[model samples]
Target: MAIINCPFCNKKASDKSAVCGNCGGKLGEMSVEELDRLQRDKRLALGQSLNNHAMMSLIIFLGSFAWYYYREPETDSLEMYAIHGAMLVGCAWYLVTKVRLVLYKRK
Candidate 1:
């Protein structure tokens, strides 16, 4: 294995390690250009995920309002249905966003 200086602590380390053993800073396995590309891709993915969450939230809010205003005095079927649907959608959106964030953080 090739010897290289650790980016974190400036200690000697093997090129194969994914992170600096001394101070735990990342030592990328890929070439500089490849690492840059990966970072860009990650950023784009995060942006897309955030956008999806925002859109879902907006949809749920509007649906809730519509359901509330459309309710009749004697019947609440429509309102209940809309609320249930919105709750399900909101939960799904929350779970997906959380998972994406967790995966990105691990990488």
Candidate 2:
């Protein structure tokens, strides 16, 4: 049997086993073709998430601008306040989501 390095722990293992005996890490179980497929999926998911974040920011910016312009001549102080409040909430939500994703991935 050919010896190969484990992808997870970098330990050497025979190609015949499904996992590395040294670290119990799965090795050579996923074919190169499967790894490529998973990588493509990950890239697509990341791209979609990034696009979603950009869209959210754009929406928030446009909403704030519209709120400011619409109430500028009406002498309504609440409009600007509402715009800033909404923007703050949206930013907080985005940050929380980002932090959660990072923490979850660490495990």
Candidate 3:
């Protein structure tokens, strides 16, 4: 008899319906605590993904740094430039991901 937003997917659905049409999420009666738990689960999953990405970036940076030092290429050679660029990009990516994760956690 009423249109309500699906708690799991935020899609419009009939309150009488058994499940969300868009995401097939269960439409059974849910308490406020359950909704909060679902939201928290989503946030934690995203945070975990970001954390993994940050770690990968750090690994990439370390690998590039080690390669640069090991090769000891000429200062202006293409290989040296490439390795340096990769190191910078990895550092920047890690920092940005960490900042985003912090902001998301604050929210």
lDDT of 2: 0.67
What stretches of model 2 exceed 4 Å from their correct place? Answer: 1-28, 73-78, 87-107
Displacement of the residue 44 alpha carbon in candidate 3, Å: 0.9
TM-score of every candidate:
0.46, 0.49, 0.70
The ten-residue window of minimal lDDT in model 1 covers: 71-80
Clashing pairs in 1: none
Encode model 3's per-residue lDDT on 1-107: one tens digit a residue. 88876777877878777778999987766654775677678778889999999999999899999998888889888998899899999999999999998898788
lDDT of each: 0.68, 0.67, 0.85
Which prediction has the highest TM-score against the true structure? 3
Q: For residues 1-107, what per-residue lDDT tens digits would candidate 2 score against the true structure?
A: 87766655556778678877999976557886664565566656766785677568657766777777776734456766788787777676667666655754564
Q: Which ten-residue region of model 3 has the weakest summed lDDT? A: 27-36
Per residue, candidate 1 scores C-alpha lDDT tens digits across 18-72 of 8768888777665656644655776677778776886777677676666666763
**Residue 80 Cα positional deviation in candidate 1, in Å, after optimal superposition:** 7.8
C-alpha lDDT of residue 55 in model 2: 65
Which ten contiguous residues of candidate 2 have the minimum total lDDT? 71-80
